[model samples]
Target: MFNGIVDVCWIPFAGFISFLIILSAINKSVGVRKAYVNILLRIFEYGRASIESASKENTQSVRENVTSDQNASVQPVKDVDANESTNGATLITRDAVLLPQAQESGNDKPQTLKKEEFNFDFENCLDYVKSGVEAIIEDDVTSRFEAEELKSWNMLTRTNRHYEFISWKITLIWMFGFAVRYSILMPLRVLVCFIGVVWLTVCTAAVGNLKDGNKKRAIVNNVLGQCFGVLSSAISAVITYHNEDNRPSSGICVANHTSPIDVLVLMCDTNYSLIGQRHGGFLGVLQRALARASPHIWFERGEAKDRLIVAERLKQHVSDPNNPPILIFPEGTCINNTSVMQFKKGSFEVGGVIYPVAIKYDPRFGDAFWNSSKYSMMQYLYMMMTSWAIVCDVWYLPPMYRQDGESAIDFANRVKGVIAKQGGLVDLVWDGQLKRMKPKKEWKEIQQVEFANRLKSD
Candidate 1:
């Protein structure tokens, strides 16, 4: 009976999946995903209310059991006058305050110089101690590298706040969610992703052989973007793109780096020539496939000469009116989606219209930040695949030009500020590479010099 059920249903199941893939590849939705998302939102609301109610109940019970047993101890007061009388002594105090001396009425000679003095105060060190402690507890740079904390539980085990066992209803709901995500959603998503990748490879390979022309470029862009859209659906990505009118036609496009999928997310909407270090494995396959039909710059991982080559290639690509805009993450590293870190000045120095794009991911659905230090590319992809969904907002800001007197660093910062503001992300001046590197000696020296000046002023 089981074999018969599987045999009868498998073919239809495969056919249905194939149909969904076609719809995704064509960038068409039947509102099924929208409806599914709505259902999930309702469930999330119910779970949030349940968790809050359970939390209140637990707090009340805890308070009831928490007895106010803090004992108060008092000591008898002694009379200062009585003690003074007993000792037969009178206390005399003198005012230690110093007043500025008045200038002599008619003296031509300058008053004797008073030597300046410096006294070390232990209290002055307390501020540094407090700052150190605060940094240890929660520093800006370190916190930006970690997973963002959610206000409420999202019903995922990875983000567990022990809310599942708070009540029987919540526990049951969690179990159901677990089964749905792992047993149903994950397998289906994997199958869809596999099909999308295979389709991209075959499609790009055929298109690569065609002569490079306007029609060929147009077809390649559509095919590549649509293929990415299909892959995005594998993770149930619900992307809301804003200000599409400002989308880049050509030149340099900059954005905050979060996850590898940031590329996929943006590419789903439009094609761009990607820039990054070449890799092996799953990413390598995708890179090779993309390079077949598009103009992407993938350099060796640790090549010293790659920078000059990349810069030259960048200039040549942007100079051409025919090529797609070069998409560059000027941050040079992935930062947790909570903040936008320092933008490298290299891309800004290239001298072209800077198209700033902002991407903000909804952590309640899933964490989109890829902590490369903690997880490998494959490991991160697995987490994304198992996640509930990838929901993000992309904003395309108006093209900005470098001011006449603006240096590349200032130009980069100006662009970074715009992206951060649009994305509702913290604007940080710290380099994102600080995640793996120690603080620069110059940075520490600057702080030290500031501290010395502060001490002198005090």
Candidate 2:
């Protein structure tokens, strides 16, 4: 009975299934059928309107040409008659009799000129139409190109700075690289890491909450650190850590800002009390989960009072031996791994031992910079997963205390200098938030000069 049913319906069913799958894939990348239909309708309307406009212009030009031709022919005839009548009495020779005919022949020259002018106008109209059509076609092409580029996994992938133009062969190789990384390894790694993270976070939180002693909390912290180590290993194809022994056991740890993975890399080695802004969306979920596992200070950056509270909390966290060392990215925002932006003074003002950690990545593997404004969390993760590998170098410098009379701003800059030096990154004086809103051209040069002058004076 089953065999008979399969023979009767299998072919059609298979075709229908294939059609549905294709439609689903298209919808996933380019939105639903209705959106595409609307886009097609818009294109059709624009083309029709352009055609109508061109036709109207052509018709108007034709009518003008016909009117001009009649005028040219009639005016020449009238001029010939007038000249012949005016000169009739004065002219008696054969040459004189043929003068009107000669004048009429000369009038043909003006008619020829009028016809040439009409032809020129018609050509101009045709050129106008051609330009309009070309513009429309270019716009369509550009929109389609952008749509396809967005569909690709490498939307925010940075171009290699060393090489501007890449060959087709190289492009094909990268395409294959993306296919293998995203299609196969990425999903498996995500599933395994996510499960490990959830289990570890929940257990750590439960144990820390239920147990009353500092020893148990410390143990949980170690386990959480190990979990991150496993995660980093799972996601990164190749990772190398330097000066791991230099990591501070306690007090404040400040690092240069780069990717979201910077925190993961730091956590993999050290048990630190994180101090950062309270984030929303999927990031907020991770923040909340980690906050449960440990006493991480998540503050609302928009609230002035909250900022003050965060400073006090940092001070308190660092002073407590039972708590993990406090970790903060003093830059407050991620810059392109090319430079270290000015550090915020809040973390530095806590007035304690500061451990500066420098982080740098080899772009030959993959870029670790998180372009948050351009990409969502999932998109960023996909980019990371699809790359060849994420390779990083971590440098831990000696701890520094505030100089006897040094201000918070000066202290922050000094720390930023150390990190930037160790990481082999350019030191920038512009505030990250300001740079984001205005742009580099507006303030970068002026700020750099001012920073240089300040440095020279000091």
Best candidate (score: TM-score): 1
Q: Who wins the lDDT comparison?
A: 1
**TM-score of decoy 2:** 0.59
In order of appearance, the predictions have TM-scores of: 0.86, 0.59
What would the per-residue lDDT of candidate 1 be over residues 1-458, giving only the tens digit for each residue? Answer: 99999999999998988898888888998888778778877877888777766666766655555533433433333322211211111122212111112222223333232345666676756666666665565565777887877655778878775878878988998899889888989999988889889989999999999999899989998999789988988899999999999999999999999998999999998989988888899999999999999888888867625567778888998999899999999988888788898887889888979999999998878889898999998889889988889998999999999999887888888999999999988887778888899876555554565455445533
Give the alpha carbon lDDT tens digit for every residue of 221-273 in model 2: 66666566556644643445677777888888999877789888777666778
Off by over 4 Å in 1: 1-5, 67-127, 304-306
The residue-level lDDT of candidate 1 at 9 comes to 93
- Model 2, C-alpha of 149: deviation from truth (Å): 19
Query: Which segments of candidate 2 are over 4 A away from where they belong?
Result: 1-172, 301-306, 438-458
lDDT of 2 at 354: 91
